[model samples]
Target: MTRTYRTLDVPVRGGDLRVGVWEDGTPGAPTVVAVHGVTASHLAWQLVAEALPGVRIVAPDLRGRGRSNELSGPAGMAAHADDLAAVFAHLDIPAGLVVGHSMGAFVSLAFAHRHPGLLARLLLVDGGLPLATPPGLSGDELVAAILGPTAERLSMRFPDVAAYLALWRAHPAFAADWTPELEEYLAYDLVPDGGGSLRPATSYRTTLEDTVDLNTGTAVTDALAALGHPTRFLTVPRGLQNEAPGLYSPEHAARLVATYPAVRHERWDDLNHYTVVMSEPGARGVAAVIREELSALG
Candidate 1:
């Protein structure tokens, strides 16, 4: 899966933001803009991008993460969607499919609401629908459960990039699935702090704000109901049970499908939240589903 990388500086409300475009496949091919989750960069879609050879993939490191750190403003879904709109304008992308994961899903949904004419369809991977905070679960507890080792790794300051990579290498999630692509992806998230130590690009405050805003699920529900374009909801079995049981469950998804009127819902039984777009087999399956939906659109 060889790729050509180019840095794009998109002008937004506050300042210019950098987006890394991994151009693959043919020119003028239908584009798929890949949006990653909170605390994740463009690398989150490495495997998925590799599998989709027929599509021209445009993945951006969202504001406050990856190459877009200099472009800071508000860190909400609406702002993120606006950043994406700027990316489309800079690239001259008329209209194509939009694929979003986790927080990226929220951004895509918001983008759909704000700029419906910019996207032909949307593929929301484990996001886009309303998420509920579990009963008896504190906000801190929910963050710990959903973010897991990634949060811990982000909190620690590594003495060097090598040390940071070592900690990432030992993660349980990547132990069996580690690849060169994953290594490169991890490298993009680390930055040198003043003390000759590396840290995650995302600030703790940014993460905290996103985690505490789960109660605003009505906004996402309203966005979904307002969306007139073709939409697909891809669910991961594990996160559906662990993070927000009521909201992510199959029954809830079915109800959402009924409510949305235009949404197409499906469940991928084997993959977890991260693996659904990060691993080869999982990405291939997801890409296949997207290809099917895109084909149906034409």
Candidate 2:
């Protein structure tokens, strides 16, 4: 069954936050709130939504990303978390499961910690745990190290959406698994810059600030120690570039699991970080886990 996809702009601190809602349209179905990665928008989760026809999914383009790119400063995990809390209040969803990918996981973590009454369950897809920061690295250095060349693309100019798609089509991580759904996800990232060029909807300053916050900020670190609800962490063996050992290296992963014994951990060696929720096999895996969590809730 083809589900219904709707777009809405929920009010936030400085401006309205864009949200994509995918639902089976069945009243009273289990609803899950999803959060996208740092540089990604809500469209990134469409594949996972398609795999769960009986579920209702809501995803937001965080402040300074996607349609919310127009939003001003005050971007960080705390601000983003508060904005998510507001999103829930605006939608009247007092409590629901939240699944976050990459940076979104941190935002979800902060949200759950600050507004525990709003989140019933939490699932972190390849993120949420405090990253093991290498010593002697500055914030910019850390961002460059973690994001690699993927971060460089944020400053590039594309002639148009087609050109951007071509760039992604050539990417080793996405070329083999590109789909119309993925195309939409990528295309939505483009916003027109003057002179007939385009750039990603995510702002560089926002990305930089967020990188600093997640890696060095207090919200996530403070929340990690106080996570009282049942939480799950899902990780991939490869990263944004399809590089091995992925985000949260083996040592870091093990340390996090040991430190937070209450949080469950699952690892997928075959799936890269991006494909873990953006491809057919990946979406199926993510949706299945979501279904399992939902069942467990009942």
Candidate 3:
């Protein structure tokens, strides 16, 4: 089924935040606010919204990414969480389900921490729990270590969307999972830079700041400790580059679930970090989880 898509600029602290809303024109439909990864736009949730035909999905381009790239402010888990609060207010979403991917998972946890009353529950995808990082790494080193070429691409300029698409087309993570939806998502990520070139809309500085904070800051840790909502954490077997042992190894994921006790854990052995929501199969799996969670709410 085809869903209607619309964009709205929401008033936020530094500037207007661009929000994407998708729905099937159902009256009084259940609403979910989805959050993308650190360097992603609202378009990242496109497939998931498509899979969820009658549900309304509201996703935002977080500050310093997508159309919200120019918003001035320090980017961190806490700041992103507060921005989410504003999103909930702007839409009058008193209590809503949330789904966060990658760094967005961390932001969702912070949102649950700061604005618990606004959230019904959480669906944290491939993130939310603290990552195991090497000891005593600087911010840049940490970003470089975790994000690798993904972070480095923020500094590079593309001649056009095709060039940018070409980069991901060759990525191991998307090689077998490539789809036109991925192309559309990647194209929306580009904005014009000076000198007739285009760069990714996500700010490298913001990405670095967020990466450091999620890995080192107290916000996520605090949120995990005080987690009061029903949260489900899904893990992928492959990492960002389609490498083995993705974000969390089985033992590590089990350990996190054991530690948190409140968060339910599941693993998708065939999917990787990026494909967990970007591909059709992945989106369908996520949508199934969302449907189950929504049913549970009723």
The lDDT per prediction is 0.76, 0.90, 0.91
Q: Give stretches of model 1 more than 4 Å off.
A: 1-3, 24-27, 135-142, 214-218, 240-247
Candidate 1, 1-298: lDDT as tens digits: 4566667677888787767666654765677788988888888887877777767678888887876766656677777888899999988986878999988888898898888899888888988777655666666676776666556666788777788788766665555677888888888888877787888988766766565553353446567768888888888776522343423778877777777758778887766676778878788998898788668768
Q: Candidate 2: how many backbone clashes?
A: 0
Pairs that clash in candidate 2: none
Residue by residue across 216-269, what tens digits does model 2's lDDT show? 879998898888778999988889898888897888899989999999999887
Q: How many clashes in each structure?
A: 0, 0, 0
TM-score of each: 0.88, 0.97, 0.98
State which candidate, 1 or 3, has the greater TM-score. 3
What lDDT does model 2 reach? 0.90
Residue 147, model 3: Cα distance from true site in angstroms: 0.8
Best model per lDDT: 3
Q: In model 3, which range of ten residues has the least summed lDDT?
A: 87-96
**TM-score result, candidate 3:** 0.98
TM-score of 2: 0.97
Which residue pairs collide in model 1, if any? none
Pairwise TM-score winner, candidates 1 and 2: 2
